[model samples]
Target chain A: MAEPVHEIEVEIKNVEGLHMRPAMQFVDLAGKFDSDIHVSNEEQSVDAKSIMQMTMLAATCGTKLRIKAEGADAAEAISALQELVEVKMFDETPGK
Target chain B: MEIKKGIAVSPGVAIARAMVIDSKDYRIPRRSILSSERTKEIGRVREAFDNAVAELTELEKDVAAGESQIKDIFAVHIRYLHDASFGKRITDFIENELVTAEYAVSTILREIASHFAGIDDEYISERAADIYDIERRLLTQLLGDVRRGVEHLTEEVVIVAHDLTPTQTAGFNKTFVRGFATEAGGRTSHTAIVARSLGIPAVVALEDVTASITSDSLVIIDGNRGVVIIDPDDDKMAEYEKFSRELTEFEVSLGSLRDKPAVTRDGEEIQLLGNIEFPDEAIMTKDKGGVGIGLYRTEFLYLYGGSEPTEQDHYEAYTEVAHHFEGQPVVIRTMDLGGDKLPYAGRQAPETNPVLGLRSIRYCLQHLSMFKTQLRAILRASVLGDIRVMFPLISNLQELRQAKMILRDVMEDLDEYAVPYNPNIKVGIMVETPSAALTASLLAADCDFFSIGTNDLIQYTLAVDRANEHVVTLYSAADPAIFVLMRSVIHDANKARIDLSVCGEVASEPEYIMLLLGMGVRTLSLAPPMIPEIKQIVRSVTIKECNHLARKVATMDSQRQIKNYLRDAATRILPEAF
Candidate 1:
């Protein structure tokens, strides 16, 4: 069977970058899906499932990133990741 | 026998031995190695350092899960540990120059920590805690050094220290330690928070505490009175024991009244509200029967993290607190950050006289963007529950008018943007400065309510720096001037048909509560724990008696005279409680 493909662009809105904790959370959520997911800024692209890679990108709070997913669950992965980043799931993390 | 006193941050009484935990006791041992083995030793140290860093990193992650505010401190520590100096110079010194591992690490750590400490910024200086934490971790990994060795409490002990850090106090074994007294720290210090959390009594900033008291000597710690009694006689010891028991019973009795209404004996309803600095305090208020939050100090959100919280941050915080009250009013005083509360929201310069310097509403109006952001956030959150906005340190009608003008602009902007908010939200002014109190009649006409902040009002009126020990003696909340100002403000507020409340440390005192009730302060807001006790006092007193006392106090010429009169009346009427 062929893997499905999904892509989306999201603008960063938080005052701080897609820093470690939030990136780690994003990776954690992406890992739940069977799809292969990746995020790309203007200069570079990295696997969305790797927290270290995501952090190294140094995405500022207001920097836009393009999310791409490819697999049987590609559309779901893209939709879920988009919603998390768009709504700033990390900022609303419990007890944070 | 000797006795010392300091500010009572947390209240309780305890009898215990002495346990002195010095920060220096946690130092690491120096490792020595031959030139031939230098490379191997450095390798081992590096590996150990890495492991220690990893452990701290993990621990930090866990702590961050609970408190995100401390994450920056942890991050700075990580950066310092990974700095080229730590790995390069220390490694080179130990490998080539042949310094002992302990000596080299200590030298580097001490130098770096001292450098950071000398930066003159409190936030950067606070990083010393991070360095200290890292050093402890490294020492434990290399030499199996454990500073906090035991957790068992065989006998009662009074912990003495220069200052207790949050981690140190949190790691303390409660059973053995009866109480703690520190030589340095204020009422709002982290050590006080830990003490309160552990249900132990503590006295802070009692200078010479370490020099005066001997270890294992019988001592009494009256945290409520901020007194430390050393080598008390049999009579005094017995009295303290009785007092301790009675206090425990009193606290338990007060706890039972947590759900009761704060009504006078003659059925006069008084609104009991909480003064909160953080959203977490709202839970405490609810637990203590607070009908609402009177003074939600927004300064703490800015002060604690050394950065301005974004509008969303303020909105979420305000929304959570408002929703917690479930329709009960939460009067949030906007960004009272300045003066002594400097180095907050990007103001770092020191002032000669912080009390009279740029602060509160005056500073807010000058910084329109920051001020408007907070106002917008508060207005946006007002729709969640009963939310009222208040301006702090409001002195004159002009300041009041200027503040309301900015608020109008914010509301208009929000309206233009189709933002959801309570359009007719109630506005109020903090009757803190003497000018504000004097012009309360005019100010009250402009605002929806009046909340007298007696802490600053007294400080400003009497020219006393409450934080300065030299002048604190002159700071009196019971001053005749304070009463006159408070009475005039309340009267003006009443005449304007606006709600009047007093939210200050003075309102927590049961004796003062009666006088305020008599002065027509229908709304009383204070710390959560004081609510029940003050409510009990209010329930026991009649309005007529309170009015009589207020009238009598109004005739007093000085603070001392008013205080004496109040003490006498309290002793006569509520002798048992007093």
Candidate 2:
């Protein structure tokens, strides 16, 4: 039997794109799910739970990323992680 | 006069033109060095890094407690501050290129900053600013002059630096520099402590003081009141001039009391002494009508020079002070280093509650070799003058016995080597904790004399941390409970026939002088500048009057009541002195 897999694509809304702090927040959200999540940009794909790995992707503003999850909570994880990229306004409050 | 308030670090008054020296403007002269000098260069780099980390860590704690927004910024900065990669890279460059560590650090920081700036991401680009701030701070440390921008000034001026390190304060030219004002520092900072020792007026933690006050602006620093006046008008200047004249007159009057005995109206003689730190300060003891050096803080031997002081270093320092005082009793306090004192490199573990943790005599007992070295040095220097060895923060008689045992061992070593010392040198303990005060009778039997350090005794009894801003309101030297403890200690010491003295700042005030005299304390040790006024009060008031006031004050419940009563009594007794 093939494990269930769900995927979604969302644009980086924050002006800073995947900066250190925002990337850390994204990794923290992904870590709360029971599913294995991976985020991929145009050049590379990395585990969403690792700040360094996600930073390596360098998903800037207006850039698109494919978020994939595989597990029993694949659908919930994909939707949650996608919501952070699509709707969560990490950029609403400016950084120093 | 435009007055600015800051935390008072040292006491005095100074009128001088401002000399603003932003340490950020400091630039290192870039040059290559020989391999033979690499070792020293490496040591410099390590020290600079260590100091930066310690400084930033302290700032981080402050920021985290309040401003949450900037706390994150410091978080990121501190993370990189301790990054192994950053340190390793700098050390590797210094060793491999054989260049000065200053040059290497500058080059590496610039390269890293440029790399971050070159990134397309704005978040990464802004990190370049953090790198720059770090670079400047590290460079400032490497300059070896915490006074980076004005290390070699020619004229007299009030130094206005962002902050001063112990090193910068040490390098101050007393002849040229009138005083100092800093934008960031605390009352307990190493710079402040040094300033107090040097008797230089200083005001610290005046936010943006360096930025607001320009160089060449006429200024007056009243460190006693913690006020700084920049660019005073004619009216204000006239008023200050009159004030200054009166001050000089008052100082002359105090000098007149130098040769007078501190005898009460009833013919009760009191032993007045000065508490000192550096060896040069011993002269002030005699000038201030002090008959002896009551408290010679020895922590500076370990603190001033980042490295641990050698046995010979301790010997020379003790011998110098002993010579300066002639035959006056010089009380050299052993290393009170662990808590809020010397932050010796690689020795103390980071303490959570330092005041309650390993400190003073306890720390000395743990580190026996360093303790023995100091004891041996003090014993050796005893022959030069009337010297006394005082152990600080002794909690119980067992600790005293343990300390005395170690002293005995060190004395035996000196005897074996045929070293000369005063065999009957008086031994004492600083009764700084309530536990020691409660059991003073027991401890009094073991020691020759007792010096009540009311500062810590009050703090411990009240369960208050004096330095903690949030709980500082609860710390009071005049609290009724403190009086009870002090009375008990005084009674016990008197019963044991052991001489006792009050050496804390509480003893320096005229109000406390009367109260302490009433409590049967006959010896007083305080800061040199305070001795004159206190002595003047002692000379006028009778022991009978003081005892009456003390009996009344003991019944007061609140600190406010006790303070008000003492204030009125002091004024009534010393109308001329006031």
Candidate 3:
């Protein structure tokens, strides 16, 4: 049986948006999970665990992103990645 | 020698060896590796990654320990290094394209960085610099060649760059970076503002500053002239060397003039006083050849101190300044607040018309207790030395009399305590407004002397709100209307036999000093640094020449003509200062 896939839609909340520094933090965090994580903007989808690919998304402030995760820990990946995009805003400066 | 002319954004001259920085691609020539060397290329790529990551981690550690704000930025760079795909992409390129490790790293990183640069969003586009920075680091390790940025500069040098972003310019160590010349940026660019605020000499928009200068090139950044000379010839070098020496010698000579009197060649004595805000500036005034304090602004005490200043706070500052020139007059101008500057603690309701609102003496009269606190301090410090009181923005005789009554009330209260004070401290009014200047003869009877505050006098007489940029152009010190008011005020003071001095922006300016002297005005209270240069002008010319110039200026109808004539006249006398 294949591992289940879970996904959630979240908004980039930080004013700096998904720039290099925040994107790097997201990819670094994704690399720690036991799942394959991918993030997609309206134009394209890319591996969330790849900083190079994540930067290609070019998601600015308020850009909506759909995060999808697949593995035995897919649920955890979905929630953590969603929290990063929505709650933590990848820990970038706010009101910038 | 090659001379490049550019817009001078900041003023000063700097001579130093050039330090070139190219922010773009390293321009590594493309070279192919033998297919057999694929393994070696991949190994080189892997090792470079490891080394770069180690270097970044070490920097991040030091930044973390040193309490730097950039530690998070370094962490991001480290994350890029540790990204699995980052290492794989370069290696994959090296293997597939049969290219050298350096070439593969440069091309792959350039591809990523260019994507960022191509983005339309400004914040997103700026990430391109970081990608370039990371690529430079990796290439530095791969090619075993050291990269030089302004941060790595250990010796004094003039930075020559194609373009410097605001971020890069802000990080420069001012001690080692004496000056800079760039190919891009206008006078009002963020880079120029930063350069000016940092007090560094910068000339931007040179177009070829970076291309013409090399690491070994000796460059002269003459920001005053907006000229950058690269590898100057022997003759040009000697000229600049003499210029550099003369500049230093001029500074020393200005200092030596502190002892010289502010008297003209015809034996006419001119009283040169200093305008100050704090006590320390009194000492600087004396050092700069000022005979006394002309306008001792007391608002700084109320504005800077967290709360309302105690009487002691006011007394201490006055005593320190008054003792600096024991016998000379120290005119303490009462708090001139609520115009453009308001007390920081009170976020007062925004007035529809701030300049016309209650300010200076008007504000003091409304807040009588605050007024009395400052008066008691002034009266108390007066006994310590020759301290005189002055009121600012006195528009009419009624306000002057009201301020005098309060001063008398405070003096009486001091007498109740048997305080040792100057029972007869002389009082004066700043003839700054049209009402005061127009009615100077009437107000002179109530005060001991008059000080023409030309800044506001010009503003009020011209009906030009100087703080507004649109009308500020019309606010001219050399305006025929302003000179008319000045003539009236000076004539009245002479007739009344009361001392008069000019304590405003006009006094510090060299172009107006001769005119002030020519107008039969013997006293000038100006910025301390201006004392020596103004004295130089006084000593070089006679009162007769000044009168002749002033007469010519009076005949001029237009402000532009008067200003040009004054600048020409002053510059002719002291060409070096102009």
List the lowest-lDDT window of 10 residues for candidate 2 chain B: B22-31
The list of candidate 1 runs beyond 4 A from truth reads A1-96, B1-3, B7-10, B14-205, B210-221, B229-245, B339-347
lDDT by residue (B547-569, candidate 2, tens digit) is 99899997889999998888888
Please list the residue runs of candidate 2 whose C-alpha ends up more than 4 Å from where it truly belongs after superposition: A1-96, B6-11, B18-144, B148-211, B339-344, B347-349, B576-578
Whole-model Cα lDDT of every candidate shown, in order:
0.74, 0.78, 0.81
Models sorted by DockQ, best on top: 3, 2, 1
Model 1 scores a C-alpha lDDT of 0.74
* Candidate 2 reference-contact recovery: 0.12
Per model, state how many residue pairs clash.
Answer: 4, 0, 0
Candidate 3 wrongly placed segments (more than 4 Å): A1-3, A7-41, A44-96, B1-241, B250-257, B299-308, B339-343, B346-359, B362-371, B463-475, B567-577
- Tens-place lDDT per residue, model 3, B185-227, is 6554444544543445778778556656533678998866778
Cα displacement (angstroms), candidate 1, residue A47, comes to 54
- Taking all chains together, the TM-score of candidate 2 against the true structure is 0.69
